[model samples]
Target: MALLPAAVPALRAENLSKRFSTTLAVDDLSLTVPTGEVFGFLGPNGAGKSTTIRLLLGLLRPTHGAAWIFDDPVADVARAHRHLAYVPADVALWPAFTGQECLDLLAGVGPGTDLAYRDELVARFGLEPGRRARTYSTGNRQKVALVAAFATRAPLLVLDEPTSGLDPLMEREFRRCIAEAAERGQTVFLSSHKLVEVEAVCSRVGILRTGRLVEVAGLEELRRLRRTEVTVDLSRPAPRLRGLADLPGVTDLRWASGLQFTLSLVGPPGPVLRALGETDVARIDVREPSLEEIFLDYYGEVSA
Candidate 1:
């Protein structure tokens, strides 16, 4: 028999909140991420996602409650950071230093770094180490930061919009690296606005609205709340086909021509499937809603 891995808390927050003067950046937020999990933190502009990341990184003090990384209080930056690596949304580098020099400096200051792995990442990310920092583009700068962070061999990775400037190919590489990190027993705390990327890489996600957490669940669970789109073509014209719209979980019915129509559906297909069986169906197509669609539903509800 194989032994199962023990449950451990890689990151935890208890009623964590932050305020700057009269503005409340985070509101009574609390969350826990288990070891070896890739957790997504999702929100739109001004949603306090960045503030929460800062609080966990010990860059900002919480106005209420507390946060911890591997049992070490986040208030102690030196001790807490020893177990994690961080990559910010906006990466800035010294203009005078070459990319290689910057990497060396970062590796020297971090807890522990794998020089061989760092070299492999540099090649995989297609970074020009000899180029001066001032000569690098936004994407290249981001690559430098990614290489340095991944080389640290830390137990946890805190990434905020880590793929902001990468092109499609590089973005694919980044996702592959994240999967490899998970295999190595490293936890990833990903804060991203790219819904597709989050849906592809994260096992669980938490949604935030107006500095407050509104929902947290696995992707499959969240998908249940979203509507699906179904388009169908009938063998013959039937004016009564519109009556199918009256079925439960069906909405936004529209006709394309004499025998074709489209509608939005929610929940199980059993009800819709039975209704279609009654008609002489020629063709049918169904598509699951994207994460972006579900996120918009939450955002719209909050805005209203």
Candidate 2:
């Protein structure tokens, strides 16, 4: 078999840590985002997601360890930023400038911006370029920032809850844009609490807990950490599912009706399937646990 080429690293962190007086804002964190991959950084409030981003952006000096953008040390902020664009959770624009003016100013200052692409983004985002920044709503301000970032030909995009202010329609648009960006070979480091967005778009996710990275895996791999919900319907009066619940992976067995029952299974399905095969099985429905459920499981363990 031919070996696939190794992916180039767009962002790399090694034992990165940060401190604010007595508080350790970010613990020894190490991770890598390969070029063109949409990597999700997930955590609850104050889980060091923001702090880690700042460190990657070189806005804060790491107390220990180091990070790089396209192999350029983040300590060299100007050089690293040349290859990346960032959109913050709370966008603040110059109120005195028109939306178009802000876009132009940002493009002029940023490296390798594509004006033609910017125009397309403006149209797609439904932005009013003529309106002053003060006249735009929160979502509109966010759109302005998003347009600037996405329109750029930057190698890396660091988005901190980029869809926070967008409505459902616009949020869908944002996801579409992200997919397009990834298709164009841009690496997106998305930090968000929105599990749905991550599950929909990200190839892999890293979970942070109280400044520590507790888990990092692909979506399918993470799903395995949780349970599967099974709903069984019996053709006749349900046979006593003796020792079924006692199986290693089964839990929360409940009989919803004379012919229906629901149970959750935590591991391989081989044992469960064999047991179900012995009964007069009419129908069976199995659902994998969602990313949110898996996140909660890891979160509960970390909290404990």
Candidate 3:
């Protein structure tokens, strides 16, 4: 495929920073999102993720540096935004209007006359098109907003905690929509405090703290920090197990709920697993840390 006329990032924040009074909302944050991949903007509460998104959308100006969407400045977002769509965390459609009417109104916002799959989207979201937006539940409103956003076939989708109010069934449907969008070459920038959702859908994640980007890598790479749980289920008492935790790349070593003990180890598992091989092994399950577990360590360090 030929290169695009401009080699700009699908989305970018170059040393972007923002300040509100004494608070530094975003501090020297930088990230480059390539085309055709889902990049999850991850952080705990008050990590400046939303503030950065607002800057990217030209809803708010950065105190320093610049915001770019498809090589164009934030000031030029309108000109370049025909290809962009945003589903804010709060879905605030007009209360008096129906779901179909909201879609109609958004259709006027862009070139979406030929929404061939609009009906399909309504069915998939299980939304009643005739129902008033205000009467809908939170999850229903999210679906209504999502159907409107995805139906546009925009080249870029900026979803801020898109699944926040969604039920499990709706979340499953939402994931499918995002997956299909990526398969069709749409770039997705998902901002969320929910790490589990990010771990499930994002190809890569960028973690922010105190308004600065602290880490950016594939979810698997982040999980690599606490990989290889070397557990030893002893038939008899082995008093030395707890003492060996600091041997090398070991952390969170403890006896779990029942018969199994868990230890997350780094490096070639040969040494650790080999050492465990000598013990009477009941079972061993080595895997990556959960997103919650990873964030606990990650945020603890940054916040400290």
Cα RMSD to native, each candidate? 4.8, 5.7, 4.6
Query: For model 1, how does the per-residue alpha-carbon lDDT over 24-72 read when each residue is reduced to its tens digit?
Result: 8898889999988999998766678888999988899999989988878
RMSD in Å for candidate 2, one decimal?
A: 5.7
Candidate 3, residue 88: CA error in Å?
Answer: 0.6
* Model 3 stretches with alpha carbons more than 4 Å out: 1-6, 111-114, 225-250, 254-293, 299-304
- Report the error of model 2 at residue 214, Å: 1.2
lDDT of each: 0.86, 0.85, 0.77
Weakest lDDT window of 10 consecutive positions for candidate 2: 1-10
**Residue lDDT tens for model 3, 30-84:** 8899888889898777777788889888788788888777787886768767668
**Residue pairs in clash, model 1:** none
Candidate number with greatest TM-score? 1
What's the distance in Å from true for residue 176, model 3?
1.2
List where candidate 1 sits over 4 angstroms from the true fold: 1-7, 225-250, 254-293, 299-304
lDDT of 2 at 88: 89
For model 2, the superposed segments whose C-alpha errors exceed 4 Å read 1-8, 225-250, 253-296, 299-304
**Alpha-carbon TM-score of each model against the true structure:** 0.81, 0.78, 0.80
Q: How far is candidate 1 from the true structure (C-alpha RMSD, Å)?
A: 4.8
The number of residue pairs in model 2 that clash at the backbone is: 0
lDDT string for model 2 (212-292, tens) is 888888999755556788999999874667568888878888988878899988778899888887889999998866555
